[model samples]
Target: MNFHLKITWYPKKRKSTISRRMVTFSYQVKVNGCNILVCREAFFSVHGLQNNQGRLKNLQKYLREGRSTSPKDRRGKKGNPSRKISQEAVQTVHNFINNIPKYASHYSRSQKPNKVYFDHDMSISSLYQEHYLKYCEQKNAPQVKVSKCRDIFNQDFNIGFKLPRSDTYHVCDEFQIQIKNDQLTNSEDIIRRLKIERDLLHAKASAGQNMITQLSKLAKENPEEYLTISFDLQQTFPTPRLTSEPAFYKRKLWTYNFGIHDCVSKKGHVIVWSEDEAKCGSDEIGSCLIKFLEIQKSQANILHIISDNYRGQGQNWATVALERSLVRTGKFKAIEHWFPQVGHTRPPCGRDFGRIEKHVKNRNPTVYTTHDWVTVIKELCKNNPITVVKMKQADFIDLTPLEKNIAKKDKHDDGSQFRFSEATAFRFDEGMPSHLKVKYQYTEYEEFRTVNITKKGRAHQKNNPFQLSWKYLKPIPICDKKLKDVMSLMPYIPDVLKGYFNSLSESKEQSDENETDVIDIGYIV
Candidate 1:
């Protein structure tokens, strides 16, 4: 019997027709005992099954067959007969399959195995942008701009070739780890070693011995000569009590007068007294010249006094003393004085004063009582030695023998023109008759030799001429009472008062007025 069958083509092969239900029909006869299903949907569906879903699914199943299989599905058994493999390869496949879970589940659509891939044209900037975008989308985080990501990537991976795919993420992790570790670790050892090295360097830089050795050598080489003596005042600060005192308190202020004397020898004595009842004005620095001269009259012979340039008290004192002496003696010769180059002078005695200050601070006295201050001053003066180096005779000489000879020649004294001849001296004496016949009368030559050779010797050739002349002409002795009298006059002779006098004199001269006359007294008190 003949059977009618319908056939259909795939969508790609379908033909357009006027009737929507026009169906192509075919006859299926039993041919060669082969059975066929000839319906349109059945033929197309069956053919599609063979070449599309069935064939693709089968191939996929075959590829994943040796990968992993579900124990529940018999058709999903692992291992393939197509690929030839050694026993070892088979064992490896078996081990891999055995390690996987027996129950199978579909892979997550969101999660996929990351595959490492390289693109020669890809830049670090592009990779960073893509990574940041993916992270923001998956984590629901804020979106970072592509420019910002590119900038950040450039900062970290400047030389960007052959970098890991997740370079930025790894860098962030590494940076966080470093910060955490650094914060937790102790670095005291490094700091302590550096401090020790710095201290050692400072100690080496400041190390030295006192410079008093040079002074000591000078002193040893000379003795009993007139050495200039001067000292520096220590720790001169504003009087704290006076600074804080009220106007009423200032009215009640009284001057505090004190005297300082170097007990070893009174050569270094000075009298420090406050001026004005409030002690607010400048300090009056007493000239120790009188006291120093009383101790040794030769101290006046001191040519130059070297001292630090204290504000109201240095070379001024020397000038005042010299002026007073000149006024008394009516001498106008200039006296020599010197000051140390500013900030260069440091005598050993200064250190002793430092020690005194340390001791005063150590005592921790709240109020400076007169008795306590006096006691401290006495102790300081007693302990601190006055470092003195006496002047020598050689220190005064300046001219050489050749210079002296030149000076003598320039004085117009020719030695030969003044010479006496032997015969002339005898002949001149023979013409003289003494008492009708003098017993062994000296000839003119002998007389001339006695006058010229013995009496007319050069003055400079005498040994120690300066000292001998000073001795012969014996200067008037300066009495102790007179010297004390000079010291007592210093308080009233302030520099301000002297300056005022000078200003008055200058003004009078400018105005062409009669010289202002005032009674002048040599003494202040």
Candidate 2:
């Protein structure tokens, strides 16, 4: 007699990266006239044979020494409650109800914000509220309100509740895992480069920590001469409540904030400007840093600045230019700039930003204009005297000339190479004012990279010729050209800000949209 056979592999044989070494296979064969199943494990289990006996020793070890997965043991519950729910009532409710609300621990709630977690078991009140008693309709069913149910659940049973902890995760794609097998053309060289980069990161992190230690010593020894500061940029929307849709879809602009925070004083200097005023670029950041230095230059003879290693803003040519310009002014005896290990920075400026955000989120006011945001922020930080300094387009300097001048007079680059990966910190000595050198690292002076400000060509963004004054507390009063249009948007604006839009400014009308030509942006009009 002839036989027909079929087989199926668990993961389908064609897929790459086998997750499991053993593939489960299911097969069936027809011999003669009867069909036969060839799953030995299933057959043995169905035939009343034990398969987990091989792991019995491990199970015994786990029961003896392994940590228990019980909430009572973790939360230090003393003893059983004075009151109790009958096991029969619990079993009866279990048949009809899907879920019963239980008690959650305070510690767990703090850890997982926005998540609901419960520690104690379901109360009699919850069951009553859930109509569990009605479903069971038994004579002995407990009668209780929500509050009494809480007491009953607390006092009654040893059955405790726990929130489900999501521990395991699955990646939908195999490519997500970097196996390093096929990519390893030469593992030795790749490992060497990895180690070099790791060392650089370690050195940078150590330098960032050492700055704190150095600040303590400097503050105690030279209190009047030493200053430590860090600065970063933040963006707040014109509106207090943000829509869930993509920002581009909302048809709105952003407000940029340049925050300079003193590490020792814990004070912040915030510069707020409209999107039309300026962008968060090297030029804007450089200007803000320069202004901050000008404010502190009179008091401190030595300045230490710590920032993150971002290309265009904090750790690039613009920053180098600012450092050189400051040192040349002779306001400080020594100036040092250090960048923390990328992705590991907890800058005080960032903390200042967080505080501002917390205040904004708590208030959640109606913000219809850029000035509205500035007003809220300034008012909130009024005690700290965080004034909203408006930056104009004219205030932004063209550093290209300075860059050229530095390289022209001194045969060396404008201390640009001081940013090399080997050095975590860079400094300019008061004695050797002309040159910039990486601190604590000795390298050939000639090997320093040159600073080229315009190395990366101009941005694609067109310059906004119209300079509207953002210093006002209200939304740039609907321009005359768009007065009717903005009035149409009034209905959509939040109720509190509706009054601001009722009276539009009678200012000069803007040119028709079709009159202005935009280079890259395509317009239907």
Question: Which candidate number would show the highest lDDT if scored against the true structure?
Answer: 2
Candidate 1 per-residue lDDT over residues 174-264, each given as its tens digit? 3334433555347666545555654443232222111123323433344233243435544431111122224213221121322222222
lDDT of 1 at 469: 16
Model 2: per-residue Cα lDDT at residue 460: 27
User: Model-by-model lDDT, in order?
Assistant: 0.32, 0.53
lDDT of 2 at 417: 35
Candidate 2 residue-wise lDDT, 245-351, digit = tens:
34223444456788887766667778776554455677667767666655655477888877766666576655665566566656678887776654433566777
Ten residues in a row with the worst lDDT in model 1? 433-442
Please give the lDDT score at residue 449 for candidate 1. 22
Candidate 2 regions off by >4 Å? 1-207, 235-249, 294-297, 381-387, 408-423, 439-525
Model 1: residue 501 alpha-carbon error in angstroms: 32
Q: Could you tell me the lDDT of residue 368 within candidate 1?
A: 21
